[model samples]
Target: MTGTRTVVRHAPGKLFVAGEYAVVEPGTPAIVTAVGRTVTVTVRAADEPGVVIASDLVAQAMRWRWRGDRLEVCPGQDGPRVRRAAAHVVSAVETVARLLAEHGLPAPQLHVSVSSDLHEAGTKFGLGSSGAVTVAAVAAVAAHHGLELSLESRFRLALLATARIDPNGSGGDLAASTWGGWVAYRAPDRAFVLDLALRRGVGEALRAPWPGLAVRPLPPPRGLRLEVGWTGRPASTTSLVAGLHRRTWRGSASHQDFIKTSTDFVNAATDALETGDDGALLHQIRRAREELARLDAEERLGIFTPELTALCAAAEAVGGAAKPSGAGGGDCGIALLDAAAGHDIAHVRQRWAATGVQPLSVGPTPERNQE
Candidate 1:
């Protein structure tokens, strides 16, 4: 943070390499990677004593003012769910304002500009757009207020902001966005922190111990060539996760089995990545796909759509392993192949085209540690 008139920050989108569904639970480990697509937020002093947000993605400008640590949008604005994109931004601003207040820095009137390439023609690419926006917004606002922040502090603020909207979320995507590389992530108790922020303010929440929160940088695969594919159909991660919460399968014996299987696969995959064992890594990737497939069939969660099934099948037919990335009724899927199989990678994309799946021209960011 500086006396510079404006502050701009960019955060990249993410893809879950393994442990998608299970990662929702606190303390569950997941492997995630930052992608090239990003959301950018720019903040500058405004002429008036209020906040104004203009987003090119939504193609609209909205005005707001902070009322007692809460963001109150233009009086008549209405949205039924807290999962809206606008809500994520609003929450991020409010959380950062709270942090600034703790340091005796006054929140300022600013105009925030957002530009995103995480979507197409108003449809999100499902590349963790929400998480990227929140991280970028948090950085921009904190810097605009001239508050210095650590990478972990910035991540905590973003998580607090996100949990206000979706308490059940794991914030794995947020971790990848902030860290900017392959990461091994574990989520803290979002519900606990949200309540703490509500009662004690965000400053206290940031300093308080978050028991299950852990993030570690992991090495990128040594021999696997990562490829991403989109199904063109968007999926609602919040609704799908909320739906899972309502099902009987959550606390059943099957639930324990899923957790164990996912844990084993994730641990093994992590080891393979660390050791650069391509054979062992491929086995774990396929194991993860099978576990997700089993969960879909048994719980009727609709984790895999026809297009997703075809996407995975096409990759396997070309001697690779693939699976749906996130909530996965539609979104995107990832494939991993031996880096030497250049021709097979092209063939997989061709087969994906034959089945209506679009190959995404995105790759993982280079290895990075906490900023």
Candidate 2:
């Protein structure tokens, strides 16, 4: 493990094109795209015996040690509580360490530095920051160990680590982070993957292809422009998702209807992408937004805020379709603008700003190490 060179990896943030809530259920597909913003991790060999992780997004240093078969966090003498942002980093390090150890290779003592462009000032824009960081960190650590993982393996490792830290996530973001470009994804069976990871070890479980994990790349629709705008307020996706779970949204007629509509939207959107049918794409986008709005109304989930409503209205005024991106109470909303609409994108941006939406300049970023 001598003379290990530094490895840097970058993973892009993601935006949900459609199939937000429904994608949480198994077999339900979501459309996601990797955006220009990214989280980058640099891993290098260190003289110390333990690993040290620092992040620009999180103003704390994470130190960890491999204790036998387990990885334990080593807080400083001041006893600072680990922030939520550190979970993904810790998860990536643990997974990588376990994989190396299981392969009879000593886990390398490394220093990992993370930086991100997923936020404006201190306000998060609801970009899949955690997923991007997890992917980047895992890739960097694995590269430092001379392990080259395929895209699917990278996705699996990120998903496994994320699920272990936050079991509620669907891993759609992780998929986009791992494989840039447009992606159609279905949530993997967590219980099965967790069992396999525990029994087969991280190295073995990730070496083989995962069953029930579907992530297919899709070409971006022609004549379509994605316009993203921030609501200037961060939303707690975990809290909103937890509330839905606590209310037993599953198995209910409303929930069933929501899923059915979302599935229809996904199919229509996929076809539209394939055929370059801008009309169909816009229609499905608006339809999906309406269905989500209805679900929020009926279930009293309050997933839609006034800001989101205004954002949709603004996009509609320009003959575009818009909706809240993820488990949205706030954060960001995305508009699918028609290239032939002849509408001034600047006008739409101005309107959005007038309504307290800050337009973001973003697009699909190339895959990690490609740019």
Best by TM-score: 1
Q: Which stretches of candidate 2 lie over 4 Å from their true place?
A: 1-3, 77-82, 207-209, 340-343, 367-371
Write one digit per residue (lDDT tens) for candidate 2, span 8-77. 8999999999999888887888899999998899999876887777877656777778787555677552
TM-score of each: 0.95, 0.94
Scored by Cα lDDT, where does model 1 land? 0.86
Model 1, 286-346: lDDT tens digits are 9999999999998788999999999999889978889999989999999998789888998
Native-to-model Cα distance after best TM-score fit, residue 5 in candidate 1, in Å: 1.9
Best by lDDT: 1
lDDT (0-100) at residue 110 of candidate 2?
84
For each candidate, the alpha-carbon lDDT, in order, equals 0.86, 0.83
Candidate 1 to native Cα RMSD, angstroms: 2.0
C-alpha RMSD of candidate 2: 2.0
Q: Can you tell me which runs of candidate 1 are displaced by over 4 Å?
A: 1-4, 75-83, 368-371
